[model samples]
Target: MAALSAAEQTVDTEHFSESMHSLSSDAEAFPADSAEQHDFVVDFIEKEVGSDLKSLKNVSNLLKKLTDENNVLEEQVLTVSSSVPPKVSAALSAAEEARCSLEELLKKERLISNMLHQHLQGAQPWMDNLGQILNQVDHIERHMEYLRCLQHIEELSAAVQQCLMTSSVWEAIRAVDSMAALDTGLSQSACSHLQDFLRETLHFWHKIIKDRLTIDFEKVLTQLHWPIISPPTQSLTPTASSPEISSQLELLVTQLLALQTSDDLLSQKDLASGKGGPSAQTVSLATPTSLAPPLCLPIQIMLLPLSKRFRYHFFGNRQTNTPNKPEWYLTQALMWMGNSTTFMEEKIQPILDRAGADISARVELCRGLLSLVQEKVASDASRLLYDDALFSHLVEEVLQFEKELRSNHSYPAALPGLLHLLLEDAVLQKWLTVERKMAVEKMDAMLSAEGAWSSQYKDISDMDELKAPDCAETFMTLLQVITERYRALPCPSAQLKFLGLQRELVDDFRIRLTQVMKEESRCPLGARYCAILNAVNYISTILSDWGDNVFFLQLQQAAVSLGDDVVLRDLGVLELGRLASLEGSLFEGLLALLDRLKGDMLGRLLEWTMREVIEKARPYGQDRWLSLPSQHDLSTMTLSSSACPMMLCVRDRLLHLHQSLSLSLFQLAWQGLADRLNKFLYQDVRRENPQKHCLCFYDLSPTSLNV
Candidate 1:
């Protein structure tokens, strides 16, 4: 048996080796084909099964297992196959019924499609006819509207003409306005010839009504002798026109206002350009009808006579037209307004009141008069600026006139047009130069004048404080004059320029004060030093007060309109700083001056007092305490008259300073002197004294020291 098993194992090993060689050959020969793999399997089976009976037996058993599984699969297939026939028959029956239903539905769809096609074909001509009817209706409506617009325009034209003939100014203006509205209401396509005719008719009536009202308005004004120019010497009231003239003038003005409609003008322009209709139209110069103030034409008409008179007197080579005397015409303009404005308010204002016009009669008259004044002033200013004297005089007069106009006549705080000519950069620079030169001259004269530092002492009242020197008082007065001159300047840039000039002058004044202080510092007398300290303190207080003043505040606010973080950069003194900052700088500089002056004065006071005390103690220094007193030295035991003189000298100096200096300043000096004297006597005097004589502090009375 062992021999048989070994033989079988040898055979199996040989056969496996052969099968491995064959499979390698098959894989190399046919890597992707199944035929090579099948042949290899057949060769292996034939070799292995034929080589041993046991292999054959294993194969036979496998074959029997496959046969059993095939039979089972066959039975399962038979079971499934038995159910397929009935289900297929049922599906066929259902399909046959669905086909019949689909045929019926298709027949109904064909019939419905034919009916819809027929209906659409039958309605085609009716829809076409309806579209044509709609077009015709639109045309007819537009034509009717056009005809109605033309007819309304004709009616308004006839009504306007009749109203004008009947002197019905208000009715005529309303009729004219209605005609304008109709003309603007029609579109550009509205019958060209008819539109041309209506426009011509409207223009004719518009011109006639306007001309007639203007004529009647002027006639009444002529009767009242309008724009009566009053002389400076004469009173303000003009020759009074009767109530009847005023009533007529009011009616004419009301008619003019009623006829004016900014909306109609703008709409007509839009229609001409084919741009917009009434709803889309916009006014350029004025608001829509009745919302804007009435046009200034009527007031301008009343100003015609005055304009002619002004041109005659100020524009030409007349004796009164000299540039040297700009105030003649400027003042005349103001005077004319003064005379006519009141009359306009009392008489013509009622017309606006009854018509519900939102405007001031006085303002209207003033503006008209100022327009003429502005032109005259500008023309003369351009020529007169070449001559400094004449220009200065002109500026002075203009300032005076502005002051009177605002203070007395209730004009605005500033009027730009009135001062616009003066706002030019070149003009401002020249003006600033002139002002600075004049200011310097004034300052020099003030400082050179006698008693400039004198106190102008008066008996002391409870309310009175130490008086400032004449120089300080006059300097502030000079500042006031400069401030008032530019207070009413209208333009922000111009006001800033003036502010720069003021700051420059302030710096110049500070320099002058410093120089004066230096000159007075060397003097042994304390009066001038006291005066200098008081002046600085006084001027500093004045500047602080000005910082809070409305005038200075307004100047500071005016600089804001330049829309800059910094302004007047060219002016070094005010570069990139506000008026308030410059004010603070000025106050700080004065304070520094005050500190330095106070310190130096105190030192000088200490030195002078100590020198006098030493002089009075010189005799005591000679008579040394080294010698013992005799037995009858009772008089020496009492306080010596020598020490009394030194104490008296110190007391007199303190009293003199108390009377000379201001209270606050005197208190600082006294306190400082006390400290220094105590230190000197304790440290310096004792250290230098070889004999170590006992030092004595005098019991100075408070009443004598004025402490």
Candidate 2:
């Protein structure tokens, strides 16, 4: 048994050695490149030997253990070998397939993108070409339409020219020498055709030019430069065909001149006459004998030779050649001269002559002449009847006429007429009041020069420099004149003594007050003016009455009228001062007035007056003289200066008023103070001084509170 066991072991050992040798040979042939390969070999050997050595208790147990271990080893080896090779092969194939699919998709996307790009590129040119083609077609169609319209217009113009040139039409037009005497139906037809032709021509031209081409034909006609004809020589050869037309034109001119002089001829009457004098029975018609012969007489008179031989032959004898002789030649010459002179005299000289008759009439005439002059000036006409020299002459003539009217005392009854004339003339109306005043002043001067009344010129000139006088003297003079005229007339007029007395009283009061204001220097000029105004205001209060006292009422009304000048002057000063600082003198005058107004209704009135000033006055600019200086620029010297001290005094006064008065009064006082402060602050800031530093320091200190 031991030998058999030995023999089995030996056989196993030998078998193991042979297997190991084969494996070793295979390993050598392959040349194992890793430690894993060496580890696998060692592990196989330990598994085969370890199981056999650990199981000595039963041979069957050993065998069973060994067999189970061998089976597990065999299965692990098979599983590793088979599963690894397939998995590796499958993985490699999958990776390659995925890469190829991805590449194919990328190529397809690229192709699609390229196709879209090419498509857009191809469409762009087609859209541009289509747009260009449409534009060309539209332009061509528009031009074609314009050309067609132009063709129609040319045809219409030609037709119109043909109609105008017709022989029958020319004869018919010539037969009626005057435009008014032409057949109504024929004229209407002609006018209609002409208008239609013009319309068509204008439309065609507009279409051709592709713009507006319409012109004002009437304006063009008025501006036409007609050629002047020279005198024809007796030896000149006449064209046979032109004679009839020339004769017809000459006849037409003769008739037109005659018709122009006939003012009574209406359109219907002229049209019905048909070139012959109106029927003998017509009520409105002038007698054929009464109407002057046609202008052909003048043409004939012009044709006569001026030689002494011809004159002698035409006059026949010495008795007929006398200056006053009534020979046919003399009569014709006189008639021609008279006609020419009449036309000129009526058109120009009479206008001025009529104007010179009275002040009002002269004013009206001057206005009309001015209007005519303006029209000519605006038109820029080549020939003006009234040149600068002529206009100056006319003005001098007007002045002379005014002088005459003043000497004659014609203005009282002519005021309304003068006003009407002035209103009608644009040039004269611009300074109507000034012109009227000048005229009145000139009259007054004349009266003074003539020594017709007391010399008020000195008083007037003195007052003119100081202020506008209340015009009370003039009003009074007018009232006195009217009352005297009314009283001196008759028994019925004697009752107007009451009216005269009242007028005299009112006038005396106004004149005396005005003189007092002018002559007296006791009070401020403003106070004196205010006093005059107060008197006028009192008169106005009486005048506004609608009650019965004819003469008394008029006297009061005159006083009221005198006040207008004062009010206007005051308002003007107020307006001017609103935009600037009030003059020191003016302010002093106002302060004087204010002092007088204390504790009275005048004080209350002042509140309203100042309110009006504040509301109506524009806010002054920052550059105004009253503006204050900035803190940085202010100096101690400035603070202690005369102007600053005055301002501070005024500010203190206003502060007192603000505290003592009602809210409204307080606000007004504060507003005045604020305006003053602002002026000082802003304006003083711009001035430079070394003392400014000290003043600034003083301002910063608590002691500045008192300042």
Candidate 3:
């Protein structure tokens, strides 16, 4: 609007200039032309001035209208311009605030982005750990499905207990079967607690069922008057209650057989699949003999009367309960077994046969009775071991009982009899210790006896036999008895243990001989010394012979089973490896003893013969012996009959040794004496120069010196 107003003003100014220029042109044209020009100009002005005046009037009106309009437009422009600054300032301030707010928002967005980045970095490991945990969970979920049966386990447990308590045999068995199946299935669970809970529940059920069966079976057995003490006669007949008792016994046996079969089948399945879990492994570890068989409980129940009787007669303070006669109780136990086992085999075995239970009632009966007997014997032996006589009787009776069980009754080897208890490592160790101690005591007593070292060569009935002193012969006999008693032991460890004990005894004997040798008077050629030498030789010969015995040889190759290395080492088996022959220990000890004897005999011979003989022979050596004696003179002039004191001493010593020692030992002693005497005569009796020596030079020939 302002530019339009300015354009209108410029057009009006241009028109006014054009009009003034026209008037000036007209004036110039009319210049200086007197009256005519003035007249012409006045005419022209009158005509044009009239039209211009009218036109100028119209223009003045138009200019006035334009001036008014321009004034109104300028006022309106001033009003708008005046208000626009404050409004623009308000707008600019508002824009500035919006910009600041945008900057703050950007800063906050950047900060949040950085925090998020840091969080992501820290959470990387967490994510990885979560992934691993999820994988483990997945794996557990795969195996945990097997334990799903646990939800009903408490219910099954209650059901089994209820059935057992109510004497619902079939229902109880079925419930037990369900629990067993659950146990077998859940054994593969990865949860240890679940497996433990399931197994505990299953085992409790088994125990409950077993107890119920035992109670019912005992009732049946009592009703039948089972395990009758006396022998059954050929004309014996059944009683009115026999059919009911037999039927009840059959049902009890059937239930037991079913449970046993379940255990067996579970074991076989685990083995067949080659998969063992805690339950399967536990079941597999149980053996019929190690633990009681299914029939063992009833068998024990049947033997209750017999056991009571035996305990009454033997275990109490009765006359028959004497410790001196363990065989009394042992015989009674055997008789009970003989009486009961036949009846069981004839009557109870048919029940098993009818039930298809593959177990021997006879064997189980004997095992039960023998178990009672073993328990009694072990109890008695524990106290009796402190008494030598009682202990010996106990051991003897136990052996006799074992022999009867194996030989007379044809006892099953699978079932451990009295010997197993007797041959336990601890028990066997006690027995070995007792034997060793007793042997040592006996050996000491015999060695200290008045005539213990006297040579029994002449006293023996057989002249051709080699003879030793009483102690040596007795020791050999004791050793033979010990060997015979333990030689038939089935356990290699027991056999090796006994063999090791024997070896220790041999070494101990050697030590005793050494002590005796040291205690004896310095008389190497005396009767006692000769007897010792003969004893050493005799024991050595016996040990050497026994070392090669088949029993010992087999023991050497036998591996030490259930034997303690420390105990075995104490027994001298450690010097030999586990499988090495233990006979070497005995042989080594005897050889050492023999060497000591030889050296002692030689040293004593030299000591005694050279004690005063050298000084006495000084006079003899001064005598001349330029001429040698004849052969007949030499033959008659044996040292035994020689009158020279040196010859007399040698003759007396050698004669004594010959009379006392066995022939072989005498030869050994003689050879040692000959060598020693030869050295002595050459070195001590004779002068350094042969020409200076005289008296017995020719008399010192081997034949003249021989006894």
Candidate 4:
């Protein structure tokens, strides 16, 4: 890259050449094609040097004034030195030294003055004078350069004729271009003659060279033994694998690319031909475009016959009938050519051992050629491989080739262009589309089979057997496969597609699980409660184990609303001072159902024990009422809760019941049941301990107070 920058710097330095002679010496140099560039250069030159005459006049006048002052000082110093006193010999010595110094200064000033005067009076006017004899020399030089350029152009014409006569089309191209670059200052008659010569000579060269190149190309086709296919050739690959195809393509690319480089060098040069020749005061110069590019016309014509075969071999069939670009062949040819040239250099460069012609320029030029074709190949290759299979095969082949290239430690300049053509984002995205569809289908197949949803539940009723879903492992495998596909593609939108697919899968699974939960809720209460708790616990456990994976985080979030798990998880007999903590009446209903179903025998036994306790309370309650401290106490004792003593048996039976049923609902039911027991026991406490001054817990009816 640094070397390329240096080459650019060198080109720019030589472009605005120091002199017309230097410009002519570098005969390849030509002005830019823009007409404005020529005028810009001329204007820049006029601005740089148009004041030379005026500057010379001012310098001459300043020098003359300094000379006159020096002469006057010399005369005054000499007079003072000659009249020096004999008694002060030191003063006389000083005066004589000063005079000699002043005299030396005058001589130097006079020499400078004379030189400037000569430049102004002699050189400047002489250069401008029409009457001067030097004008004849100027005219002679103009006529001589005109004759020289004419001779050079004529020699070029003859060279073209000679090359075509011998069927050397490459040499004909060089000669024709040599004729075109002749920018000799032209009078009307000379220009007319030059134009006529070009019109005739170039046309003849074009006709013969095209024919010659075409013949050469036909031989190339025969040498390769390629199939002669019709227009819009079949898609095939074996022909492109041939090593000889690249070698033959290189031969054609090298000749044309060299010509293109020569034209480019010519175009950047602002000045042309000799400045030693007379100025173009009367004659107008020819436009630089007269010799401009598309300089490889012969080469392009040769490629036309070979293109059908090349397209079939390297590019395959064109799908559309729309005509391919004429220049598109140039890019295809350049790629194969660049690789071939680089390969040849590797083999040949090591063999030379500093013995012969340097291949450095050839190598650099080939490297430069790759950049010119990069954009075209990148665009064309992307369009060619839109099919998933086609794109996949091409990418695999390119990657394998790239791997081999690296293993050999060979870096070809054209490899970047080739690789760029294969690694297109559109191609990657196409693969991602295929991968996503396949992944989703595989996932669907795993779960869409007979009783597929049931299989995922896998003995969830048995806690130890409740492992991850059967499809979980297979789903992960598919996920990984799709993830790798996404990694290979490495696109923003592709990554989004991957994430979205996983999200949908997770969501669908969660929705199915939620549906199962709702369905299970319809079972007998005990069974339904156990089913929901076990299934949700198993799911939570499995999901939690896979919890670190982001996909499972979505599942966990879905499981949040799965149960009253949050309400049931921490409630115990110790914490059940109230039933308000439960989400709704479901807790109360569940407790009653459980007692009816599982605790019925225990309830009947407690009822039998309470009947015996209620029989013992018959008369003790009536005697305790007469022993009351006052009538008010007796009035309060009108009601008796003699059955409250049996509450001890209730507490004991409740303890036994509590031990057997410790669920959230059992604890909740106990809260209301305990309060009712307290209300019955309250009347007994007031009647038995009258000094306690407490009222009866119940407001008994008169008939009901008989106990």
Q: Pick the candidate with the highest lDDT.
A: 3
Rank ordering of all candidates by TM-score, starting from the highest: 1, 3, 4, 2
**Residue lDDT tens for model 2, 1-707:** 98997776676666666866876777777765435665687686666565574332244454578799999999999989988988999999999999999999999999999999999899999989999999999989967855654454455445434533563333322322222232222344434554344444433422222111112211221232111012222322334544553444344333323323221233333345453343222211221222222222112222222223334533345554432222333233323332333222332234334433212222333222222222222222112123433332333333333343334333333222111221223323232233234434543553234332222343554433212223433443544443443332222222233343343345444445545544533332233333343434334333333123454344334323443332124445564443133222212223333234322323443343334333322222112332346555755523333234444445555554433333333454456545544444334543433333433332233233222
lDDT of 1 at 263: 34
Tens digits of lDDT, candidate 4, 1-707:
88985665555434433443453444435545335655564575466435454333233344467689999999999988887755488888899999999999999999999999977887777667755667788889988976886787778878877876786767878876665444322323456666556545655655455455556655754554422223223332436545675455455545444344334433332124343132121011211233222224223433344444454543445642212442344434444444344333543233232323333433333333333333334444466555555455444444444444334334443334234433356655565566556556765686555543332434444432433334444565565555444433323333444544554554454444345445644332233333333333333333334434554343233223332243334545433323333222212322333234323322333344445444554443444444445544454544345545544555654564343232443444355445443444356545566743433433333233231
- Candidate 4: C-alpha lDDT: 0.46
Candidate 3: segments with Cα more than 4 A from true spot: 1-225, 231-301, 308-327, 345-356, 377-396, 419-437, 455-457, 461-464, 480-508, 553-587, 606-656, 676-707
lDDT of 1 by residue, 131-165 (tens): 99999999999889878877887788788778878
Question: If scored against the real structure, what TM-score would every candidate get?
Answer: 0.63, 0.23, 0.56, 0.30
Q: What range of 10 consecutive residues in model 2 has the weakest lDDT sum?
A: 209-218
Residue 294 accuracy (lDDT) in model 4? 28
Cα lDDT listed for each candidate: 0.67, 0.38, 0.69, 0.46
What would the TM-score be for candidate 2 when compared with the true structure? 0.23
Off by over 4 Å in 2: 1-120, 165-513, 516-707
lDDT of 3 by residue, 1-707 (tens): 88986676667657756865776677677676555655665576455435553344344455477699999999999999999999999999999999999999999999999999999999999999999999999989866764556667888888887876786778877877887777677666677788678767776777777777877787777776665777766433678877887788788877876677445544454465667564334323332344544334455456667768877887778999887888887888778777776578767889888876677888887766665676677677667756777777788778877878888999876666666566755567778888888888988898889878765556654662455888888888999999878865767777766776777787788888877777664766566776777788888778778767777666655634444452244444365552364535335545666777756765675567566556555555665455555445665644322228766666777787666667777777677767766666766656544763543435565355445
Candidate order by lDDT, decreasing, is: 3, 1, 4, 2
Could you tell me the lDDT of residue 27 within candidate 2? 70
- Give, for candidate 3, the lowest lDDT window spanning 10 residues: 279-288
**What residue runs in model 4 are displaced by over 4 Å at the alpha carbon?**
1-158, 166-170, 176-211, 220-442, 451-470, 484-707
Ten residues in sequence with the least summed lDDT for candidate 4:
279-288
